[model samples]
Target: MRVLLVKLSSLGDVIHTLPALTDAWHAVPDIHFDWVVEEGFAEIPGWHPAVAHAIPAALRRWRRDWRSTRAERHAFRARLRAQRYDRVIDAQGLIKSALVARQAIGPRWGLDRASAREPLAAWTYRHRVRVPREQHAVSRTRALFAAALDYSIPNTVADYGLARERLPVPSTAPGDLLFLHGTTWPSKHWPEAYWCELMALAAADGLRVLLPWGDETEHARAERIAVAGAGHGFVLPRSGLGELAALIASARIVIGVDTGLAHLAAALGTPSVTLYGATRPDRTGTFGEAQIHLSARFPCSPCLTRECGYRGASVVRPACYEALDPARVWAQTRETMSGSREMAHGA
Candidate 1:
């Protein structure tokens, strides 16, 4: 069976869909997938063996320079419509994703109005699956696939099904820690001073630290962290998603704020500690073995706000992050690493 999956943009959401692909592939080995994802994340779907093609959709880019990118968008749509798919699943139940699914040549399937994040998007689908909203994002996607494909949802752990061997190992020694501090939201950031303290703790523990960055702002922050590391931490060169994945796969442990790279690390089966500040991890936290989520216990936490709204004394900073002390994070990191080792040794 040929299927077209529409889950575009944002690294974490795209990664969350991988397990569903794995489930579908295991149930029907002959099934092949053609995934439509944002151009920036097009490489993700190809990581799964069952995905035959990773079609790049440039809705975000096109909206910026519609006239200049008209030809490219036309070409992309042409390529997408070239093959007739047996079914098209809109796992991302947003208007933009639903519109993308409509462009394909198949009966569009998606979450029903009651279950969809955007009720308007449900109208675009020929078939709507009623998935619960309270479940984890990975589980929701798996359930959606099972309902759409007419198969029983398997009661198994979420398997990302990424080809780990495809990534080249970096020249890093064992016990090295990768710090993922770059995130989109201000509220999601762990205090810089806290990061420095964590680096010092890692240094005392004789573990080398590596910091990866995305943009100039994040790069500057990483540079500061490296400087504060006192020769124990170093800033990594700007890398693409694949290269970062390779780095994460090679790391002994990863300490990160709530970000897509953290999710990627968990998907890669890396031992990671993800600190949650502004957002709650109940539904969207990383799902994998050796993954630990440390949520902020502040009263105003999990507000899900993009910007920080703390009007208290400047000394207090963001109260949400105070509970996640660097020492506490380091302790958890050590514990997670030790647990992972024990599990590997059948302890």
Candidate 2:
């Protein structure tokens, strides 16, 4: 069977969709699985051995320019239509994704709008599988396919096989923990002062700390953490996604906020403790991978709002993360790392 799985954009969402393939492939071992994904995230699907092809949907770059966009998109559409896939699964339930799946020369399938992350995206599917809304996003993807194909969903299987390059871990004993302190969205970030305290505590325990910064603001934030920790912190050179993955793979442990890199760390099977604020771990947390700590103390938690509102509030102000104490996070970090070591030793 030539199966086409459509999931594009947002690193976390793509990571969540990975496990579905394990069961899908098992259900159809002779299947040739090809994923339609954003160019930026295409590397992820390429890491999976079950995937026969990683079809790049350059939607991210498409909106930026017209000439190249039209040329590339036309070519991509032609190639996709030529495949005549046996089954096409729209894992990403968006209007654009549905349209893309329909463009494929195959019988189209997707989640019903009520079950879709984006409900409106469902109308475009030729067939919609109604799944439980409460299911975790990863499970939702797996269940959607299972429901459509009449195959049982398999137990969780986390496998991402990245090709090894010349990138190698340094020979020096790892004394420092990697702290990913920046996020694309401001609402998801933990308080800067809290990071300062965490870095200080980690360094005090004789662990060197390095913070990787992407932009100037993140660089400034790293500088602030370094100054607060009295030079125990330093920023790493700007890195591409693959390099960042390699770096996270080498770290003894990763301490981070709830963001893409943090999710990447968990998906890579590295020891990590991610801080959650407005988001619920159940919905999109590290799956079958690493330890996760969530702050559910706030009454308004799992608000699902990019911004929190206190009774009569409608803006994106998040107070849930602010209530998380540094000491509590530190304790969780230690426990997670200890558990990771035990798991490693088969104890």
Candidate 3:
């Protein structure tokens, strides 16, 4: 079966869809996948054994300069309609993904109006499936694939089918910590001061702390954290998705906020602790083995908003993040990786 999968953008969402491909491959040995994904994350689909290749979609770029990008849009549409697929599945319930799925040549399948984020997206599919919205993102995608492909939803731990060893990551030494400090929302950021303290604590215990950044602001924050730590914490060179995956896969431990890299760490099966403040873990926390999720106890936590609204006086600016202080986060990280409360302080 040659399946066309339309799941575009947001690194974590793409990672969540990997297990569904694995399910399809296991359920039907002859199944192969060709993905329509954002050009930025194009390499990931091909990493899975079941995937034949990725057809890069530049919707984000095209939307930026729509008038000038007509030729590119035409070319992309041509690529989508080039080959007839056994089934075209849009696991992402967004209108953006639905538009791409509509252009693909196949018997289209997707979430029903009740299940879809954009109800209109369901109209494009020949077969629409109803999957509960409350489940984890990984589980939801798996259910969608099973309903579309006519297979039982495997009652097993999701297997991403992409191993850490697939990347050419270097061998990292023991007691090295990779801090995934960058995130999208202001409400999701664990305080910079908290990060510095955590790095300092790790360094004092004879650990090497590694930091990576995607933007100038993140680079600056990382630099500040490194300086305040006054130990082995240092900023790595700018890296791409594959390089970041390699880094995450090879790290001894990962401590992170709600970010795509945190999800990547989970996908790689790295020992990781992901901190949650404005967001809850029930729906979309990092899903994999050896992963720990720490959510805030603040009253307005899991706010699900991009910006903080609290005007109350608190130790932490976001306020909700105060529930997940540096000392607590570091302790959790140490305990998670060391697998013992005794080793939480790096004893």
Candidate 4:
């Protein structure tokens, strides 16, 4: 059976949808998938064995200046509509995602009105499946795919079907530990001081720390962190998603804030310690083996807002992150690494 899976932008959201393909791959016989994802995250779907094609969706880019990109938008629509599939599943329950799913040639399926984040998105789906929203995002997606594709949801832990050999290993020696500190939201960012402390802590423990940066701000932060970490810490050159994925795959342990790379580490089955301040870990934390999450003990935590309500309320910008300090994160990181090493040695 051929299926077109529509799950668009936001790096974290795209990562969250991987395990569902794993589930579908295992349960369905000869099931082929074509995934529609944001152009930036186009590399992800191809990592899965079940995905025959990773259809690039430039919705985010085209929408920036819709009037100027009419021809490109038209071409994208034409390409999407050209392929007739057995099923087009809209894994993302947003209106924009619904629109994308509607453009595909197939019997559409998605979360029903009550289960969808944007209830109106359900209108586009011919077969509306009701998956509970209370569960973690990974579990919810697994259930959604099961319902959409006529298979029972597996009881076992989620498996993101990414292979080690598929990734191109970087030529540089792998760092003993990788620190993924860059995040999209201000409230989600762990303080630079805290990150610097963790880098120094890792260095003191005879661990080489690799810090990756995407933009100028993150580069600056990494530079400061590398200096604080002394000789053992190094800042990596600006890397693409694939390069960063390779780095994540190569690291002995990954220590990160609540970022998409943290999710990538989880998906890659890398032992990781993820610190959560403003966000709740239970609902959408990193899922998979050898993953640990530390959420802040603040009243306004998990506010689910881009901006912090308690800014300037305490020493930390978000104030909630005060509880999730460097010492706390470092301790957890050490414990997780120790556990991973012991497990590796069959202890």
Q: Using alpha carbons, what is the TM-score of model 3?
A: 0.95
Write candidate 2's Cα lDDT for 100-182 as tens digits: 88889888899897888789888887899988877778788888878766688776565543444534444333434788888
Off by over 4 Å in 3: 170-175, 340-347
Tell me which residue pairs clash in candidate 2: 176-208, 307-316
Cα displacement (Å) at residue 290, model 2: 3.2
lDDT tens digits, residue span 1-347, model 1? 99999999689999999999999999985999999998899888878898999988888879989999988988988987998999999999999999889988998899999999999999999999999899999999999999888899999999999998776566544338999998898889899999988998998887889898999999998898888778899888777878788888888899999899999998999989999988878888888888899998777888798887977654445667888898799889898888877888995
State each model's CA lDDT, in order: 0.88, 0.77, 0.88, 0.88
lDDT of 4 by residue, 199-293 (tens): 88888988898999999999998999999878988889878888889888989999888999999999999999988877778888999899998
lDDT of 3 by residue, 16-85 (tens): 9999999999998799999999999998886789999899998888889999999989998998899999
> How do the candidates rank by TM-score, highest first?
4, 1, 3, 2
Q: Give the poorly placed runs of model 2, Cα more than 4 Å off.
A: 156-176, 310-317
Q: TM-score for candidate 1, please give it.
A: 0.97
What RMSD, rounded to one decimal, does every model reach? 1.5, 3.2, 2.8, 1.3
- List residue ranges in candidate 4 displaced over 4 A: 311-313
| C-alpha lDDT (0 to 100) for residue 147 of candidate 3 | 91
> How displaced is residue 275 in candidate 4, in Å?
1.0
